[model samples]
Target: MTAQHGHTADRATTAPPVTTAAAARDYARSVVRQRWDSASRTAREEDVVDLLLVVSELVTNAIRHGDGLAAFEVALAEDGVRLTVHDNSDAVPDVAYGRGELPSGGHGQGYGWPLIIRLAREVVIEPRPGGGKSISVLVPLHARP
Candidate 1:
């Protein structure tokens, strides 16, 4: 899957398969953090934290709930970051938690979608041309003070 952010040309990279959601989340976090940090010196710490949070939640959801992760991408736009995670399931996520709730998980509770919507400038879920689905979120990269 590709994340279109209208900045530098989108480059696709494959993350090696990992067993657990935690592993997937960690790998994705590190990859994006490194890339984004290198790509934009002006990106704020808060913005990178938000970017990582969104990355963790989305990739974790794909690993835990969707039919496993298919691919992941982080796109750096002129003004923001775009994150996309692809999985084998076609299910569209529902926002369960209120906007104010913290996104950390609980027993049989969903916090990712709501937190994503609350944090991201925009969120989109679209069906893959072949099969499955992709969830993408765009986050503004605010300049550090």
Candidate 2:
């Protein structure tokens, strides 16, 4: 699903819930000023939109593949925004660049990470400190058109 990232004219605000992926991402659209504001502070509409989508996809993957015990968190820093999805599953996600063509599939399921790579500045899927895996994406604050 394509999402529209809207930046409000008001100052920064901490979104409630921050519980589920959908909730957290939906709140991101409303965060305008950001937590750390400086001369270099900035936020892009496209970047936020893509970031939310990535978070949603990763959360879905975790909930679907991982055990019931799972939690996700989002942080907005000066350099960029971070999204962490923690799940009980230790298996890391496989990156698919999709340089070639897809031979079609049942139910027409494909094309998620590939879009993510194209959207986000950096995407990293690594294991957490103790257990499970965390998918972190860094969306640059100073993105250009």
Q: Which candidate has the highest lDDT of all? A: 1
Report the error of model 1 at residue 77, Å: 0.6
Worst 10 residues of 2 by lDDT: 1-10
Would you list the C-alpha lDDT of every candidate in the order shown?
0.68, 0.56
Per-residue CA lDDT of model 1 for 1-145, tens digit only, reads: 2232344634544566665556655665565456544533556777777777787888878888888888877666656677778988888765622353554556435667766877886677889988889887787776555
Which regions of candidate 1 are displaced past 4 Å? 1-40, 96-109
Locate the minimum summed-lDDT window of 10 residues in model 1: 1-10
TM-score of model 1 vs. true structure: 0.71
Give the per-residue lDDT of model 2 (tens digit) for 51-82: 77876766667677665326655565555566
Could you say which candidate leads in TM-score?
A: 1
